[model samples]
Structures are given as C-alpha cells and as structure tokens.
Target: MNEKLLNNTACAMVAPGKGILAADESTGTIEKRFKSINIDNTEPNRQAYRDMLFTTAGAEAFISGAILFEETLFQSALDGTPFSKLLASKGVIPGIKVDKGAKPLAGAPGETVTEGLDGLRERLVKYREAGARFAKWRAVITIGNGIPSAYCIETNAHALARYAALCQEADVVPIVEPEVLMDADNTIEICEKVTSDTLQAVFDQLYLQRVLLEGMILKPNMVISGKKCPTQADVSTVAAATLRTLKHHVPSSVPGIAFLSGGQSDEVATAHLNAMNEMGGGPWALSFSYGRALQAPSLKAWGGKVDNVADAQRAFHHRAKMNSLASLGQYNDSLETVA
Candidate 1:
C-alpha cells in the first residue's frame, strides 16, 4: 500500500470548508433524474449535464473532489479535455463509484448489500491509470420491523472491508459508506440505534481486514427520522444525534466523516450539516458527500437547454457554497432566500 498517497487523498477529501460532489449516479439512476426534468437520457445529455457541473467556474473553491460514474470517468468535456483532467486542472480530485448497485441479501427480506469485489483490484488499477485517485463503494442497510438483521449488516460490512483493503493495495483511497437508509416510518431513536450498529459493524470489519484507517473516508448518513415518520427531528436534533452516534462508534483514526445527504431535501441537508458544525463538529471533520441535494436545483435549471447552462452552474455554485459554509459551521437558513 502506498500509505503516503492514501493518507494525502483522504485528508484532501475532507479538507475544511470543502466536500465531495457525488455526480456518480448510475445509468438507470440518471434516467430517472432526466425523466423528472422532461429530458431524454441520451449519452450526450448525460455528458453535457455532468460537463456543466464540472466546468462550473470557481466550483473548485468549495468542492474538494468528485465521485464519478464509470461513464463520466471515461468521458470528455466540451473543450475536448478528459473529464478527469478537467477536474484535476481545477484542483478537484477525481474518484469513481466502484460498487455495483446493492442487491437483496439471501434470506434477508428488505435488506441489501453492495457488491463489486469480483475484480475490483484490477479495475482499480485501470481507474487509477485513468486519473481516479480514490474509489467509493456504498452498502445499503434498511430499517424496518425484524429487519437489518445481524446477518445483513455483517455481510455488507465484510464486503466493505474487503473492498477497502483491495483499494489500498491498488494504491487508491476508498470512501467506505455504510448507509442506514431513512426511507421507512421509523422514529429517530430507532434510526439512531440502527446507525450506531451499522457503524460498529463496519469498523469492526475494517479492523479485521486490516484496512488502513487513516487511508479512507467514512460516508455515512446522519441520524434522522424516517421519511414517513409522523414527527421528524429538527436540524439541531439530528445533528446532535448523528454526532453522538459517530463518537460512540467511529474511530478517530479515520481522516473524516463525509456525510451522505441520503434522502433529505437540499436545504434540509445543508441545515443539518451546518448544525453539526455549529455544535463544534466532532473528532472527525463533518463534511458532505451529497448527490441529489447538490444537483436537483441545477438539473431543474438546466432542463437540458444550452441557454440555461450558466443558470444551472449558478444553481450548483450556490449549493456548493452553502455546504462549504456548513462544513465550517458558517452557513445559515437566511442565505437560502438569496438569489
């Protein structure tokens, strides 16, 4: 393992006032997003949309790095620059989503584990050669009655650890994400318990597989009430709960906790992150690794029209700046009303 390279990549990923841009949606995922905006999900459309985000002027100021889909990793920008080169030129490290989507676990109803280890080591070498310095694999854990069993968590944790170990071997940093989904009607306390258990399992596996703690970033969800929950926890409450859970479970040896926005609304995601930082953050740097929350507004603004490219970029820049301030505990709700 190239320890120095891994450590440097991890630190840059979670640098203060900056976070990761998860423009790494799979083809099927991007299709749904395109449908929402009444646009065709063509290759050109995908490339154009991503190109707009990557080439946004001054976006690198708040964006430390970006996680890319396989297609984007190999695509080129309008100016004929490879997407990875364009991002690096702007000082944003390029990364790739290495996991295939989560598949249902055997005999575990309502639970899924991420899979991509079949040939990840070889792929990592190619990805690195193509300018990807880091990789991401997300494991999905759902919350429901009699679900998220120990079997499910353990299986996913093992996979995550194996992936991390292989990544380091390939000299690529890994973003280990074990997301306890918030799609149910569960209460905040239940979310809390599940998130803690999931983190504990992930870390235990990381240790067992001998992955370097300082060489990876943790991308987990914040502890919050489920989408269908009758009562939702406020931003401050979610922030505190998330902090408490991470402190109790995650090791400080990890470089940072770059949170996934999960299913939160854009402003809500920004608010929760800001709240976490306001409360003095935690032992790890509290940053974001958001996909939809950072892209929804820009997608709407662009609507696949060339004339709206600048508008889309402005929307993206605004969200990036908001989350940047949140990373430093400097963002406020009032800024949302501007522009």
Candidate 2:
C-alpha cells in the first residue's frame, strides 16, 4: 500500500464540515425512490435523478466525498462529464459500493452475509482507474429474540475485513460499516450490546486481516432502541450510549466514526449526531454518512419538477449544513431554515 495514497484517501473521506453523500443505492433501491416520486425507474431516469442530486451546486461545500453505485461510477452526466470527473473537479472524492448485495446466510435462517469478496481485488483496481479514492461495503445485523447469533456477526465482520484489506492494498480507503438493524422491539440496552459485539468482531477481523486501522473509517449505526420499542432513548441517552460503546470497543487508532442514519428522520439523525459530538472526547470523530435521512427532504422538495431544483438544492444544502455543524457539535435548528 502506498502510504500517501492511503492517508489521502482517509483524509478525503473524513474531512471536517463535510460528510459523505451515499448516492450508491442499488437499482432496485433507486427504483423505490423513483416510485415515490412517480418517475419511471428506467436507466436514463435513474441516471437523471442521481445526476440531479450529484450535480447540485455547492454540494461540495458540505460533502467531501460521494459513495456511488457501479453504474454511476462509469456513467457520464447529461453534459458528458463522468460522475467521477465532476466530483474530482469540485474537490470531492468519489467512492464505490462494491458489495454484490447481501445474501441470506446458509443455516442461519433470517440473517445475511454480504457477498463481493469474489474478484473484489480486480473490481477495486478498475474503480481506482476510474478515479474512485475510497469504497464502502455494508453488513446488516438484525436484532430479535435469540437472533444474530455469533456465527452471523462473525461471517459479516470477516467479509468486511476482507474487503477492507483489498481496498487498502489498492490504495483505497475502506468505509467499514456493520449496521445493526433497528427492526425489532428491543431496548436501548439491547442495541448497545449488539453494536458493541458487532464492532468488537469487526475490528478483530480487521486485525486478523492485517488491515491498517489509520487508513480506514468506521461507519456504524448509532446505538438506539428499536423503532418499535416502547421506550425511546433521549438524545443525551442515545449519545452517551453510543459513545460509551465505541469507547469500550473501537480503538483510538481508527480515525473517525461517521454514522449511518438507519430509518431516522433527517433532523432526528442530525440531532443525534450533534448530541454525540457535543458530549465530546470519544475515541473517534462522530459525524454522518446518511442516505434516506439526508436525501428524503431534498427529494420531496424537488417533487420531480425542474422548477423545484433551486428549492431542492436549498433543502439539501440546509440538511448538509446542519449535519456539518452537528459534526462540530454546534448545530442550532433555529438557524436551519435561514441558513
């Protein structure tokens, strides 16, 4: 691994006041987004929608990097510039999501194991040639009664580490994400336990794979109760729980921890990140790498109308700006609208 390249990749992904934009939705997922807006889910339509989001003016101000799908990485904008070139021109690093979708684990009934290790090295090489500086792979962990057995967590963690090692070898920073789903009626304590166990296993595999800790970013779900839990954790409680869990598990060698806003409302996700940063002095930098939580409002503002582009940009900018401030623990909702 080239030292400078690895470090540069890491820096680009975790630059301050600027987080990552997860525009890497799979075709089916993008189709779902298109369905909500009544747009056809054809290739050109999907490209156009992503083009609209990626080409938003000044998004580079709050977005240091963009995580993209294989299609977007190779596709050109309507103006003929490749998405990677557009991002590079604006000083934003481009990344790719390499996992070949999650497959149901064998003998583990409802759990999943992420696939992509096969030929990942070659894919990483091609992505780098196409100007991607980093990459992401998401591993899902579900919570429930007697579920997410050790076998399930370890399988996913091993894949994440394997992917990370390959990325580092190709001089690409890996955004290691092991997200524990909030799909059950579990308590905050359960979320904490699961998150802790997941990270512990993730890092252990990273160690076994001899992946460099400094050259990677850890993106994990914040420890909060299940969506259907009777009692919800307050912002402070959520922040404290998340920090305590990371403090006990993730080492200080890892540079930062940008969160995935799994099923959170835009403001709610930003508020949680803000609270975590406000608490301060944890092992890693707490920021965001949100998808739906960040894009939903902007997409709504757009309403698929060309005339609403400015409004959409404004809404997108607002959320990004808020999250940027929250990354520094200084966000104020009163300023959200005006800013």
Candidate 3:
C-alpha cells in the first residue's frame, strides 16, 4: 500500500471548503432521476448529463473529487474527452463505485448487504489504470422493528472492511459507507443506536482486516430522525448526535468523515453539515459526499433541454458553492437566494 499516496488522496477528498460529488448513480438509479426530468435514459443522454456537470465552471473550486459509476468511468464527453480525464484536467480526483447493489441478507428478513467483492482486486486495477484514484462501496442497513440485527450489521461491516483492504492494496482510497436508511417512522434515538452499532462493527472489522485507517475515508449517514418520523430533529440536534456517535466509534486515525446525505433535501443536508462544522474541533474533517442533495436542483434546471445547459451548470455551481461554505461552517440562509 502506498501509504503516503493513499493518505494524500484521502485528505484531498475531504479538503476544507471542498467535498466529493457523488455522481455514481447506477444506470437504474439515474434512469429514475431522468424520469423525473422527462429525459430519456439513453447512454448518450446520461453521458450528456454528466458532461454538463463535469464541465460546470468553478466546480473545481468546491469539488475535490467525483465518484463515478462504472459506465461513466469509461464514458466520454460530447467533445470526445474521457470523463475521468476531464475531471483530472480540472484538478478533481476520479473515483468509482465498486460494489454491486445491495442484496437480501440470507436468513435475515428485511435486511440487505452490499456485494461485489468477487474479482474486486482485478476491477480496482482496471479502474486505477482508467484514472480512478478512489472507490466507494455502500452497505444498506434498514431500521425497523426487529430488523438490522447483529447478523446483518456484521455481514455488511465485514464486506466493507474486505473491500477497503483490497482498495488500499490496489492503491485506491476506499470510502467505507454503511448507510442506515432513514425511511421509517423511527425517532432520532433509534437512528443513533443503529448508526453507532453499525459504525462500531465497521471499524472493528477494518482493524481486524488491517486496513490502514489513515488511507481510507468514512462516508457515513448523519444521525438524524427518519423521513417518516412525525417530528424530525432540528439541525443542531442532528449535528450533535451525529458527532457524539462518530466520536464514540470512529478513530482519529481516519483522515475524514464524508457524510452521505441519505434522503435529505438539498438545503436541509447543507444545513446539517453547516451546523456540524459550526461545533468545530472534531477528530476528522466533517464534509459531504452527496448525490441527490448536490444534483437535484441542477437536474431540475437542466430538464433535459439542450438550451438549458448553461442554466444547469449555474445551478450546479451554486449548490456546490453552498455545500463548500457549509463545510467551513460559513453558510447561511441568505446565500441560498444570492444566485
């Protein structure tokens, strides 16, 4: 493992005032996003959408890295430039999503684990050669009555650790993600317990596997109320709980904690992150690795129209800039209306 290179890349991923752009939606996932905008889900359209994002002016100022889908890793821009190269040319690191979608965990009803470890080393080599310096693998943990059992959590954590080890071995920084779904009516307390347990297991497995902690990033869900909860926790409450949970579990050796905006609205996600940074003095950098929270407005602005390319890019830049400020605890509501 090129320890120094891994540490550099991992730190760069969570650089102050910058974060990762998770453009790594699977084909099916992007198709659903396109469906909302009335755009065809053709390869060319997908390529065009990403091209607009990658080419957005001033994005490099806020976007340190972009996590790409397997297909997008090999895709090219409208002008025939490889997407990976385009990002690198602008000083953004390229990353790939290495895990296949989550699957049902055996004997564990209503829970799932992420797959795709088979042949992952080979795939990592190819991705690195293709200009990817990092990779992401997400494990889904559903919170419901009697769900997310120890078996389910351990299974996914084990998979995440193995994947991280492989990534470091192949010279790629792994973003270890174990997302606790916020789709239930659970309160913030429930989310916190699950998140805490999930993280503890993940880190324990990472240690057992001997994955270099400083060389990988932790992309985790912020402790917050569930989407269906009658009363949601406020920004400060969520931030404090998330910090407490992470501080209790994640080691200081990790370079940073890049949060996944799991089902959060764009503004709310930014607000939560801003609140966390406002508290200050954490073991690692608290940043973002958001997908919908970062791209929803841009997609709406684009609306799949060729003439809206400039509008889309503007919207993209605006969102990225807001999150960038949020990373530094300098964001406010007034900035939301500036553009």
The top-ranked prediction according to lDDT is: 3
TM-score for each model = 0.99, 0.97, 0.99
lDDT by residue for model 1 over 1-339, one digit each (tens)? 989989999999999899999999999999999999999999999999999999999999999999999999999998899999999999999999999989988898888988789998899999999999999999999998898899999999999999999999998999999999999999999999999989999999999999999999999999999999999999889999999999999898899999999989999999999998999977888899999999999999999999999999999999999999999999988898526
Q: CA lDDT, every prediction? A: 0.94, 0.89, 0.95
215-289: candidate 2 lDDT, tens digit per residue: 998999999999999999898899999999999999898878889999988888999999888888486667789
The reply for model 2, stretches above 4 Å from the true place, is: none
Tell me the deviation in Å of residue 169 in model 1: 0.6
Could you tell which candidate, 1 or 3, scores higher by lDDT? 3
For residues 1-339, write the lDDT of model 3, one tens digit per residue: 999999999999999899999999999999999999988999989999999999999999999999999999999999999999999999999999999989998899899989899999999999999999999999999999898899999999999999999999999999999999999999999999999999999999999999999999999999999999999999999999999999999999998999999989999999999999999938899899999999999999999888999998998999999999999999997899626
For lDDT, candidate 2 versus 3, the one ahead is 3
Task: Report model 2's TM-score to 2 decimal places.
Answer: 0.97
